[model samples]
Target chain A: MPYQAVPCRVLSLTGGKRDNDLILPINSSLSVTLHQDQLKTTTTAAASRDFTEDRLWLNGEEADMGHPRLQACLREVQRLAHKRRGGSAEDAGPLSLSYKIHVATENNFPTAAGLASSAAGYACLVSALARLYGRDSLALQVAPETHWPELRVLVMVVSGEKKPVGSTAGMQTSVDTSPLLKHRAEVVVPERLELMMRHIRERDFEGFGQLTMRDSNQFHATCLDTFPPIFYLNDTSRHIIALAHRFNAHHGRTKVAYTFDAGPNAVIFTLADTVAEFVEVVKRSFPPATNGDPFLRGLPVGSASLPEELLAAVVMEPVPGAIRYILHTQPGPGPQLLDDPSQHLLGADGLPRCSA
Target chain B: MPYQAVPCRVLSLTGGKRDNDLILPINSSLSVTLHQDQLKTTTTAAASRDFTEDRLWLNGEEADMGHPRLQACLREVQRLAHKRRGGSAEDAGPLSLSYKIHVATENNFPTAAGLASSAAGYACLVSALARLYGRDSLALQVAPETHWPELRVLVMVVSGEKKPVGSTAGMQTSVDTSPLLKHRAEVVVPERLELMMRHIRERDFEGFGQLTMRDSNQFHATCLDTFPPIFYLNDTSRHIIALAHRFNAHHGRTKVAYTFDAGPNAVIFTLADTVAEFVEVVKRSFPPATNGDPFLRGLPVGSASLPEELLAAVVMEPVPGAIRYILHTQPGPGPQLLDDPSQHLLGADGLPRCSA
Candidate 1:
């Protein structure tokens, strides 16, 4: 069986309790899911006939198939598949429930480097699994890509270095130790999620941008409040934040908003109108290192001249190559199956076609 | 009449509501006050019959005499003095309430550089006023300097650059915007202050160090929660924090603690037994740039040998000259009068003795 792999950009992660057994959103959870053309993970999942055991390969290397979350996803997918086929496997044509599964996933971006690479990987893995087993995806989309055409995303790679504290362990420690995390989960997030959803639905960029920046700050605040504390945003990340705030302050409004995950990379959201100028601002603030790889990638941006005053306004010491690169992208369609045989990540030998 | 000058270090700022008028401790407030032989603000006050109007000189420049807080301190002192003399101005000598005052103050460290120089300045001003007016000082002492002789303070000067945001304005904005700050002020501080005082009384190094670190982190957390998000702890400050935590974890208990005010400099608290080793660790972590100022100052630190394992455990890229220098000192009595006439900052001409 062949399947499409879905890679997603998690705009805002708003939830407390994580359910290891289910793929669907809980009642209390609300996340804005969209797709970006760049920074994706491709997973090839198949129901194997000859193999006697379930196997998994991540980025061309063999990984534990018995990982709890992986097991949970596999179990849920199979159960959903069974339920879909009139509560039994007999209704399915050739795919059998007893067949062992083989999965291989490859990420275009750095894995576990806090660029939400895991989100894309997990999403792709589960989507591929669901597709192979004749089950529909249970992921609840807050809004379609068409809902906000002007919205754009910039993935600022401050550091692709592996996160000192990965998200799972960080969140667990935060849940156990942070009082601010408890307050944010129970009291702050619910109302904030509602406002975010409304802002997205109404295409209210100002409200949306402000809330996004504040929520990001508050989330990191809780991380700092954790016992022994967790530091995800390094100096470069903070400089980016200062630049964002300064850029907005210069405009006298929220023209751009920055968010950070479990690592130092910054995900900035802005409108199509503001993107060019803000990109210029970013370039001026964090000049690319000489003789390095290309500084900008993905969707092309128009040339915009930075005003002298605007350049002066964003006061920061330029740290060359602080940002590895800038990935410019926008709201895009979800997973699509590749009909051509050459597009398959796994080859005829049932192994990764290319090493990561 | 001539009066003594004083300077002190604010060990922990535990209360939220600030009084613009009084020098005494508010009912809900509790702070650990200690004096350092270095890093002080010196002030000289005199009741001058020759002067036509009250005047003030700060750091060798003639400053406004009508500043609200200064006027408030003067009025309070005069009222206390009048009351002490049977509520009659006639009972006093030639050094009467009606006489115009001349005052001069100087800070050895950088002013408003988040070293709590303002605290020292204010304490010195009020003490000088009280001494000249024959009124007893009313500042409540939580515990005297002799109580914790081994409790050492290391003022790690990460940057002497004036802070991006000053404490007064920053706190005002935080109070107006940050929900976490409000919660901390109203709900968190009261309980934490009690524990801090208890830790001091019990001489519980573990409890005291842990609480100190957490409170410092929480205060900065609230700062981050403020609108536009105030960022006082820069990269160097965060690196110092990481070093402190790693050092403690290596020992399997709390041996050292770090705190930050509204700037990047770190005020680390540790016991005498741990100071030498920790200073060695700091020197290793943030090695001094060649030809720069001396790395350590103030109280003498004995030689210490760092174990290979301990050095390997605290892994951080040595940020050369990230910390300008470390000022090492300990608890001492506050607000001592300089009886020798030569110590006065103001000469017989009622002007600053030296230009800043």
Candidate 2:
């Protein structure tokens, strides 16, 4: 028997809120899924008569196949699919194949280290494979990619030589030891999630942006509360936060909102109309050094002033060359089916068409 | 009558814990009163009919005498002294001469910027005035300075261009907004204070050291949890913390403890024996730039190696020139009387001797 392989890329554009999911979190949390136009991980899974075990690749390089979470996800999905069909693969007579799977995923967002790049990559892999195999994804229930129309996400990648400790591990430590994290989970996050969902429902950008920034603040505060506390934002990230807030203060409204994850990189949300101005402020405040890499992508922008009004509000003195580049992108669809056979990674033989 | 202004310096060699003291804090906090041999704020005050009003000086310059906290402290102590005599200033006229007082004060620790320098300064003022006017201090009730003879406080002065927003103001914001601070004040500090007091009673240096570091971490965590987030610990303070922790882990015990006040300066505590090695670790981890200011004062610590074990434990890469200098001193005593009249800042003419 041979197994089907599906290739998938980036997923998540506008984040979804998880409110009644108490399995892991004590309260609800909202997160905007990111959609990187060019950054993706192509996952190809196939089972063959000769295949002996599951195999995995990350960034075109083989990675350990025994990761606990991956195994758990795989096991749950297969069990659910088996129940849905209500028959064993052997007895189903062409309904399915039970060969071992070999998955190859190549990532293009390697430079976005410690900022949960794998999250979007894995989301794409699961959703695409579920569609190919005619089964529901066992990991998460999410809305269609087209659900949100106006959201945009820009990732400001700050360069640092040392890799940060994985945020997943850090969060676990905080959960176990930080009293602040406990209070936030039990008391604060539930109400915040409600307010965020309300802003989302009403399409109130101001309310959404304010809630987004505050939620990010609470998350990082939990990180800081951890014993032998964890620090994700560097001086550069602090400068970016100040710049965003000061810009908003200057406008007397929320024109832009900024959030930082496990690393110093900032995810800024703004409208298409305001992106150019905000980007201009970033350039002037933390200018790229001469002979540095390209600092902006997606929409083309020109020089603009960081007006005295905005500059006066910023408390931090920006440090130049702290950021390596900025990936400019807009809100778009989640994972989608590719109609062109040329775009598929799997070949007629059920192996990868392009050699990893 | 002339008020004597005693010099005040480092305030946190011993820490106080808040337990059952719910009026302010239900818990008992142990603090080692710091006696900086050179870091002093001298204040000399004289009361005379010729002097029309109260005046004060700070660092050789005139300072406002009508600060709310100062007035409140002064009024309460004067009231307490009056009640004990059970007579008005007019009834026992010689007991209390009605005269406006003039005062002068100075500080030598400029680089020792943020850690609530004004606390020790004000503490000295209250205690000196209490002695001069024959009253008890209304601010803090504590054992005499002679209570903790073995304690020492070393203030490592880290330099920065901008001063942090005062810690007092930072804490108030945290209290009003940070849920973590509420949890700490109500649930966490009570227990932790008991442990700290026990450690103090038993003279358990290791226990005290661990608790000290943890308490500081909790305080800063609450700071981070505050809205708009207060960041007092810079890259330099972080480096110092890592140096201290890594050194302790290497020695397989807590030989030294570190705490940060509202600012970046590190208040380090260690037995007199461990100071040399700990200072060695600090110097190597954060090497002095060539021909920079004196790296350390007080005890002379020669060059030493950063052992492989200790270096392997530190997570932060050392940042150089972030610190200005280290003021080395052991825990001595609180404010003391300068017996020599020649040391007074106020001269016979009821004006500052140095003509401030």
Count of residue pairs whose backbone atoms collide, per candidate: 0, 26
After aligning candidate 1 to the native by TM-score, how far in Å is the CA of A169 from where it should be?
0.7
Give all TM-scores, in the order shown: 0.92, 0.87
lDDT of each: 0.76, 0.64
Top-scoring candidate (TM-score): 1
- RMSD (Cα, Å) for all candidates, in order, is 3.1, 4.9
Q: Write the per-residue lDDT of candidate 2 for residues B193-307, one digit (tens) a residue.
A: 6787677667688887887887777777777767667777776776777677667777888887888777777888877676666777676667777774687876555555666
Where does model 2 exceed 4 Å of error? A1-23, A87-98, A138-151, A301-306, A312-316, A346-356, B1-30, B87-98, B138-152, B302-317
- Cα lDDT of model 2 by residue, A1-356, tens digit: 11222212111111121222221444554555555464455556655666787776655556787986677656655666666677555535233446667666655665347556656555656665565456654433244435556566677888674545665566567766777676777677777767777776677889888877777766777776676667777767767876787788879899988777667778888876777778877877777878746788755655666667666665356678887777776555445565666666656565565663
Model 1 chain B scores worst on lDDT over the 10 consecutive residues at B20-29
Task: Give the range of the ten consecutive residues with the poorest summed lDDT in model 1 chain A.
Answer: A23-32
For model 1, residues A1-356, the per-residue Cα lDDT tens digits are 34444334444453233443453322244444445456566778877678779989888899999988888878877777787777863747458877988888887777777776777777788788877876667656678878898888888987444577867767766776766676777677778878888998899989998988887888788788887788788878888988998988999989998888778888898999988898888887788877668889888988899888888888567776788888888876667666777777777767777763
